[model samples]
Target: EALDGGPLARLHDGDLVRVDAVAGTLDVLTPGVLERPNVRPDLVANGYGTGRELFAIFRDHVGAAEAGATPFF
Candidate 1:
């Protein structure tokens, strides 16, 4: 399934979820379900890969400068 956000977010109204299933119709599952398919397709397929890449970038950016300090609360 495709991750949400990124280029898809700008072009689409909702999040950029992956195409989980598209057999005769589009079967999408996002954080929330608020929309439905407009038309059906001829065949369907299933695949999986990284959903989003931005989160990784942010994590790496924030994770690199940890100062090795701990909280005392």
Candidate 2:
């Protein structure tokens, strides 16, 4: 999963979430979800390494994944 600059980073365990791609919306159903403490991820290691070089500019393009992490057909 990705925890970039988005709501997914703030969400915690047991929190309710709703996503409607058609309507283009993402909502947190759990009460006081935002009131909880912010969860900051360790982004230092992501700057380089971790097999990221595989996606270098010379590599073939990789298709995008859908909501369920399914690759485009």
- Top-TM-score structure, candidate number: 2
Model 2: lowest-lDDT 10 consecutive positions: 57-66
lDDT of 1 by residue, 1-73 (tens): 0122222223335555555354533344464444432333322232223654534444333421134322221
Top lDDT: which candidate number? 2
lDDT at 69, model 2: 44
Over 4 Å off in model 1, which ranges? Answer: 1-14, 17-22, 35-73
Q: What tens digits encode model 2's per-residue C-alpha lDDT throughout 1-73?
A: 3343355667878888998999988889988766666667876555458876664432223333334443433
Backbone clash count, each prediction separately: 2, 0
- Tell me the TM-score of each prediction against the true structure: 0.18, 0.47
Clashing pairs in 2: none
lDDT of each: 0.36, 0.61
